[model samples]
Target: MKIKDIVNRDVVNLENCEDEAIHIPGLIQPHGFLISIDADKEIINVCSENISQFLDYRYNEILGKRIDDILGKDFKETLREFKSNSLEKKTVFLTYNDQSYALTIHKSQENIIFEAEPNKVPLNEEGNLFESSKRLLSSIEDTNSLKELSQSVATAIKNITGYDRVMIYKFDHEYNGEVYAEVREEHLEPFLGLHYPHTDIPPQARALYIKNLLRIIGNIDYVPAKLYTYVESKVDTLDLSLSVLRSVSPIHVEYLKNMGVGATLTVSLIHKGKLWGLVACHHYSTKFLSQETRNAVKLYGYFITSQIDVRILNEQYEVAKKANEYVDKLSSKSLEFKRDSLTSLFQDDAIYQLCNGSGFSACIDGKVYSNGETPTEEDIRLISEVLFDIQSDGKVITSTFPRQNKGLGSVAEKFPGINFHMLDDTNYLMWFREPTIKNIKWAGDPSKAIEKDKKGLSPRKSFETFTENVKDTSKPWLQPEIDACNKFKFFFQSFLRAILTNEDKEKQRILTENLKAVNSELENIGWISAHDLQEPLRKIRMMASTMLEDQQRFQVTEVAEKRISRMSKSAERMQTLIKDILEYNRASSEEDNFEKVDLNDLLQEIKKELKETLEEEKAELVIEGYLPEVSGLQFLIKQCLLNPIHNAIKFKHPDRRLRIRIFDDQNHSKSDMYSVISIQDNGIGFDNQHNEKIFKIFSRLHSKSDYEGTGIGLAFCKKIMLKHRGFIDAQGQPNEGATIRLYFPKVS
Candidate 1:
């Protein structure tokens, strides 16, 4: 159905669904018996209809009885000694009537669940878990691609476990899963590429999958064993999330029965500590895996996950390499039109590769550049107003018009594909995406999962090929498109800064004038609209916070938690951007109250502003010796100092204490008309070749994982220097440190 319906209902709606929860089923799989004991170490709960067969005690007598009363004194002491090791899965077995019984004890939500299964089959003492693991590992050792790896994984698991069918199910961003790979008997109908809605595996079930990591059901049609407990047991329901023989949800069992599946086994494929996907095994008839074989499959899952990670990294590297090559080509073509840097800072082709569009537009300094089938200048200004209204985490906004998504409305429809990359806050890189109508294939009807029935609203379970011809929508911007924007934006901005940050005074003066001229329009409009736009973003952040705090009350489970966390992070980023925009506007203002500024006083003010951050990072800021007074804008000087110093702390080396040493020997000036101040930090250093480019606006070398920032700090420092009629420069060696030297002219 519709995404909005699913978004609001997926977690909150608790209609009778077999997948939602099974822990409190009040029943157990007939294959085993379940008993829960609280802190008092007495039998507080039971679910076995045949407790006598396993424990040789009456079900009613077991309630409120200690283990000694049920299994005798020596066995209770043996259980205590077994539990003292604090192992993940503790076990002890006893032959109660010439029959071997296997007992497993594991703690769940502070309550210990005692599960005992009859060792129905004769033990094969010769079976080797390690040998089974090695065979499984060797089966897929040479797989190099995801497709090959997935195929190998499915085939190997099927062969090792002897299941009738094995499926490699992978999850998407929205939790919807696709059967990526499958291996089954040749006569069976293929479900190779079928997709399953997220409703099929509700929040509680997915959470259980994450907790247990492996699960098995011996038979779908077996009757559930009823649990009996004292009326004063205090626990109305047992948290069977970690139980190996937890009763399968009745609805889930029915769903499986409908599909003609008899038994099942599944293992989680985890990547970077998150549930990535699963290896779901199905049988046409009743089946069971030996404990040793189960352990072997688990170990095999670990290697498969690692291989998946490796293949993903390789694919990403390939994509990035290709994008870099494309950027280099775009840069080469752009040089032809940038004949004169002063007349046209952007020849309209500068951002074309960065934004794959039929038309391109750029608003920077006070200048506007446009080419191809772009919106009218007035329309561009109007669209830019809308662009300035919304703030995003990545400083980029994209929309597919057919969905009637937010940002630039009819303007996006006119072009079909629209992307606005905020250079800072006001200035942007805009592209008009040409429309191309095409048909999309979905594995299911894609209707809302919830439907009203005779029993009221419930999840719909119809999956069929639904085709819809999407119109007025350009090709969607994939992750690669996003990477393209981020990568080339870095390149283009660095190119601009390299041209501007020159030592030659005449060239610098010419370029600085052009920079201000091209970007002045954005600065003017941005200041007035900023305050009004900020409140909505704050409201959005507040909503996210409220939802997260009340998550449990509203039944916002793991699924909604992830989405809300992302929303919170994005909103926080937006707020930071808005504030940065405000600071930047004020920092760039020409109204100069240039005065004798004491360097020591400014540093102290900044230190006060960053006190909490300094304490958190455990960083030390050292000012060496006496500081010289310079004639400069106090606010402008603060902007210069604030950004660099903050960055020094932000990118501190995790392994060592951060040290930022400010050295001002005042040795570089020959005529006393200029004095130099160097801010040095022993943090992640960059290559010397990129030192000049790093000062450019939005120039960043490391990704957010290595370090996170909008890449506007040093750019502001450069501008603040240019405002003071002084100079700022930097020198760095990779992994050593970086020194940003600010040359304040008229020091005397």
Candidate 2:
């Protein structure tokens, strides 16, 4: 038994094998069973019909060499066993990835033999098709129905294989078929739910499928039916059953014949020992697949079928469980079992906890009773019409909302609603409940349980037994319901952020507008008050001028002269009051620009301006050391200090000369940007109660005979300080002089 004996002529390179000791023929299939292995259990073998190309390695080169030294590195141990055992015929069945192959291993005197044809396919998987298939299986766990599961599988296959189209074709006892699930390119039309008649494929074509478990039609247009030479019966020429593999299922031949398909790879889905369906992957153009690739795809098909079975079983369970849960949650809490109360069943946050349903609705008579979004009366009526059309016994239909209801086609304005047919009578038959909000009442007493518990010490003690059932945490968790219920959480978070931002911006805008209005009002108040009072003051001033002018001319009467003199003095006082009021208004309108002004230099200049008055009045004006620059309206601030200085000098006591001092200090207030400016004067000071009154326009504490001018000086000074975002305050009593403090913000 030599390796050369079984080698097929096509598989043997005579030129390369010239140095070999012997060559044996008619022993085994050449390419079908030559084992190639390396050290570290890395195996490379070709079970392919064209084995010659794969076994190009030198005979001696692979004897003791490791996979890294010959074939490759990091090969799975499972693959090493495949090549090693495949050579000895120890394993008659071959399993790669997940698909199992019933292979005949024939060992003759020369080499091993594998009696199985090979095929190739590209699983939509970009890389490592096995891993991709595993993920697809895991994701399929969430599939709800057979149709859904099939659809998921189709999509998964297409995604992993990068195929143009993949379909799950369900066949009946007859050859009739329907596309249960399908995934196609975006540009291609969907084949969902499209049914083809049984005669479309014919009976003879179906018989072929029974023999050809898996077939790869690489090029449908060029698929030439191979003549079976083993068939020697002349009378059974037209019978496809006589051949080892029937002529590519007559149903498929006819299907391709009608569809003009270019290529196809079909894997029969056999479940429970019965022909279930076929996972049909199609290509629109001539396609070529390596045998290795086809094997990978078959493995995927096997895994998908298993997953489908599990998912279908789980789906049945889920449906029953969900229906029971829904009935329990709604029936017990519903007011008088009124379905409309379902709208109030769950809070907004709880609505999102339900499932993949983004928005929810409960329809009565096909009319939406209530939903998360507002539904117009007409929309409700349309929905009612659709529900009315469903006369079945609470049968569920998985369909898009728009397709079910014409009124719901546009998702733009109206929120999409899913239809759940609850078999009920004509009267109040349907209740619109939002799926997103259903679970909310589960945690609390949906029907006034909280209010009922108010008299009790614990809220839980207040809830009814029915409420406890709904909130049972012991129940197993369902992902769909959770996804549906959690939608409310996102809605709440987003809504709060939007509203707060708008409100904050609105408040800021309002404040700015109000400040502008106040500023305008201040100007108008100043102008109106000053102008309105000037008229009376003008008349008085005119009368005084005339009285003084005519006093000597009309002096024939002494009593009359005295009265005229008094009238003139009073008129002059009135004019002074008017002037002071106007000056207070002017000070508010005027402000000085901030600049570096030496405090000591300013004080020195003021002293020089008033030196004569101070010298004659025997007043002493003193200033302290170097002053820092402070933010202020320079001219206004000067006027502010000047008014107080003049007042001190004017009120100088006859008993002693006046003393005035100006200085700055730290820790003036909580504000750090402000510099404190204080002036203290010892003179004839008024009572403490009159401090505020002195800063009011025309508010005179002293009689006209005592004071020399109108009482607007201090008021004008206060206005100047206020305009600079500053303030002024005075302290004084009867015998002692006053001290006035001014605060100004620094420019920098």
Candidate 3:
């Protein structure tokens, strides 16, 4: 019958078979009888319809009865012990009517299921299980190569099960199956090395294989026995996931019949919780294995699964070793050079052999470099864009056939395989492989494996060998090759970071030297300009003074005399500006003229120099406390002190006594870093907001008519303090008083 008729009605074609509820089939193979007891109540609730064939009572009569009523008190006690211990599953041998059966009990949902099948294998065969398994495991351990391990397993299982053919089938990344190793009877055609598409075993079947671990079909043509449940018990569908006598799918049976297989046994090999492959045994005629024999085979499968990871790693050890050597060489070379390291390394043969590629190409700093054989520039650019679209975390993107990507189909023939590694957005390295022709042998025509007729979809009715010439596809990239590329990408990125860091340091050093040279030239120009302007100012002052003296000789009027007086004053102010400009320049350029100066002695000199102005303004210069010695240029320190004291006397309020205090700030002297000296006066103080602005050259708060001096006085003070690595601060409010404090750095 078509699968749609016997299986779930939703399964009309192979595409929909993945959704089939094979785990809850509600039927058992006719060779065994199943009984489910309510775990909490200790009562029988479900049984196979064929149970009457083995026992005296029918399934209907057995259902809804207590376990002790059917199997006696001793059996119920055993069941209770099994439940209390919480064992996964237990198998016990039971004899009734002079017939022996293996009774397997396991928990399913809220029920405890008991599946019994006839034990027909000889006791001697079951007795040798442990020793035989030990020998098989030893053989596998001694075999270093993966192929040798597969062949040894196939040969050993065939000898144990007495099957016509035993094959070690392996699945690729895409779940496609390949007959990796095989041992068969001489009369049978060899099915070794034949490939099968993943569709042959849908996702649901693979999932069941992982869950159940092992399955055996005693007679492929045998009828399925339906399960019978008590109506009042309300068990809708029985879970046959852990049932050893679970009925096989009709579609699977039909597929096997087409291959002329009478019975089959499949053992799942699991690694890291995933279904790795299977040990498939096929018999040309009907066969059945006792529970003891099946358990022995399962133990062998477990041994193989446990060793799969280690064996695979052992196989790739040599490849990884060589890749490490290449990485070390490339990284060392990259470090030896400061620039063009990537460009130079890209030309080396080591990069091409790093991943065992036929060709290599690199895009660095907008330049493309190539070695060995590579695709055209245009094709390379297109491939790079595609790789960029899928780039992630410096992962190596590998493709066995470039044609698989729609954008790369046209260039696939030029380079069928590629390993693309993107270092960044605009730079990458790619390795390529040329097209290789392979003659692949499939068990059947994979393209037509699943056929549709008027009834529904069906398996192909052919097992004869089908060979096809597969072209434009290179040998697949191995995991070690991909791993090597990833390692190289990491080294390349690290090298670039190191190079960029060193380059930035070198650039900073060059810029610092250039800045120093530019400052020296500007200082020289300012000094020359200030010295040259002094001569012109002296000539102008002389001319105005002579005109003032000769006013009566020229009969000069009152306006004329005033004009001469104004010209003389203008020239005098110009002379003061040039003098202050020269002082500012000297402060910045004279760095080696530092000396220890006594501030008390310097203040006495300043008071003597300003004696005439002090007497005229009627100001009091009070030295509040003893001053400390500090290190600075002597003349610049004099100007630093002279400017502020003069301004304090000049800007004093007219209504108040011009009392000026000259003292060392005791609070500032307590600190070891700096000494502070303050000049305070009751003057027409400026706003506090102009504290910073007033220090700039030529910055004046009052007009020239009110304040008769160059605006460079405070600016000169700031520059001198800066030359001594010191600081100056101004604090005041309008019409109150102003205090200018100078902080001189302490000499160590």
Candidate 4:
């Protein structure tokens, strides 16, 4: 049958063959026919090229004939075995008459069918071996990680040795072998990270590897002849076990056979006269080797292993150099922050200013520090103790105390956090924060467990199983590539630092300009509140004084009392306007004691403060939903809500109640937390044209006579929101109540 016809199908009848003689027509032309005999050498059947070819002998005559008479002893035995076995379909390779044939046997109820074909060997005819090796070397040389180098070495050895599979088998401290890298003929599995038991390659074999450095097994099944020597009747014994180039041990071959491997070539990767690892090559089929080929491959193996050694040195140099650069930059950034000096100016007793940990302080030496509640000396002492331990080992360390330790180092135990690195001999860089769910798992295989697993499974199975095991277990390590990329971190950090520093300076300049503008505006408002508003009140006082003095001549009447009441009302309106302006100014000023305060708690507090106002207005400050937790000043957020909610109640269009709602929006940036609080009112709303105007101080659409007080409430709301790096906007028609939309950013 053709190879394609029998693919994926079961072969039948070959399992039991009664006839000794079988027809094998597909053999070599000179041996076109095959004759089979039973164990007694009796000719059971004969197959010829044509019916006439077998005409010379009748079927009864051939059946009783001794097959060895014509077919020879070897041919008879080969045929006898074919008819005796129980394999339904059999494919076996045999060398007969110096020709190799892939003989396929099929059996039927009445007869046996045999087919034969030549098996071709693959030759390295193109001499692409050196080119393949060179390409592999070039591809791997750029790998800057030990893991990457291991993988590259495994792949290169596979190509150079022409092995079906090759692996970089590293020996652990316990002498257990691990496959750090592997390349296979099939893509079915990976074995790069499997770990195999130490017994796979026994202790004696491992020790021999350290001394010999190179081993080549040409044919695993080959047996060496016994040697005998004598000179002048003196005999000398040669210990084959001690010879580096001696043939492989028979026991080792049996071991491999038990594991199903036909051939293995191992090149020891020696480091300091010990076996660090092996460039292990495996062949599914037996391999034949020439002395010249063996030596050449050994020399090539030496070159590749040396490359790995040198590459590791280069990588260490690179890491140290890059780390030093970043450390220096961090030092420079800290000094720069200190020299700037304005952080002190921005400090307030009630606020925890992150002067030392805002920008550069938070980002020095790959650690981020932030301004929050200042740690106590006790906490600092505990933190120093932990830092001492981490500095010694350069690994993550943590400690904790009950009841929320307030000492300096308590932050380390207070939160689940990770930060550890070698900064210097005396100073180890580290970051400690409360752990969140985000830190428990990250998007990386940093532990390299996958690489380790493959190494563990390598030597426990047959060559096929080992090959398949490796293909299944190997995991590519990319961190070295990523770590190498960190070489540019100096440039990146410096660039970012420069941008941030310049921006800070620019922001200071802008703040100065803003402060000037604000002062000017406040001065102008001062004039309105002091001079303008005062003049109306002064006129009312003078008019009242003159009227009282001339009361006898004027005969005090109801008309006079009404006129006086109108003038007093206008004066009182001016007083209220001045007070609103002062409140709005306070909201917009940058001098507030800003600090972290729970937004939810602040909102509740504001509700309590405005309880009387809300009750009197018969307005339910519904607080429609849960308040969002945000980082801002407690007092400021209280003011933010107070102005808006109070306005909602104060301006209620006589027949309606006030309602406010709060919730968080998830549409913000990944790192930002955004909360929106919308305060809606059933109050007398203004025209859309005045939406923008209402936010300005003293800008009012309704007269004091129509409304109760000043228009500064909305303006104050806008100021407080802006102070928090937030915003507020109004929406409504002239008759409908307004909805003041508030957006509070999650982060500053």
**lDDT (10s digit) by residue, model 2, range 68-151:** 453233233434455566543332344434434333333433222234323333454346666666777786676666777777
TM-score of each: 0.59, 0.36, 0.87, 0.32
- The sequence of per-residue lDDT tens digits that candidate 4 reaches over residues 1-748 is 1011101111121221211111111211211223323333353343322212323443234443565554357655666677687645455666655656555554433334343334443476226556766776787667777777777666665655678788888876667677777888884355566666555565667766765565656556654322211122121222222232243433355556665567778878787677788887778778744333444456655755667667676766654555455434433443233323224312221111111111111223333333343344354345545555645344432222222224433354343232334334433323333322222121122222112132222122233322221111111212332242233333334444665787789899999999899897976677566656676677886777677568777676878867876777777777767766666656655476667666667777777887887777677766555656666667667777777776666677765565555444344342254566667766777678878998987777777676676767777878788887888887877668777777877644
Tell me the TM-score of model 3: 0.87
| lDDT, candidate 1, 1-748, per-residue tens | 1010001123224464643555666667777777667645555554456677676675776677676666667568766765687655666666667766667778766567778777654255235544555665675667667767788778767766889999988887667788888999999878777777776676778777887888989888887677766666656566677778877765567567656789999898888777788889999899877665676677767767888767766656666566566666656654422325523434535355444566778776656778777888887887777657654763544546435444566665777667777776556777777778766544556565445565544444554555657667776664555677777677667665655555356677889999888768778678767887788888988888898889877789899899988988887877777777677667777687789999988888888888888888899988888777888888778888877788888777777889998867567653266678889999877788998898887788888677778777788888888888888888887777788888888655
Cα lDDT, model 3, residue 560: 85
Model 3 stretches astray by more than 4 angstroms: 1-15, 126-131, 334-337, 359-364, 375-382, 394-396, 400-405, 408-440, 465-483, 554-567, 593-748
- Candidate 2 lDDT: 0.54
Poorest lDDT segment (10 consecutive residues) of candidate 1: 1-10
- Model 4, position 408: C-alpha lDDT score: 34
lDDT of each: 0.71, 0.54, 0.82, 0.52
Order of quality (TM-score): 3, 1, 2, 4
Best by TM-score: 3
Error of 2 at 396 (Å): 32
Q: What number of backbone clashes does candidate 2 have, counting pairs of residues 3 or more apart or in separate chains?
A: 42
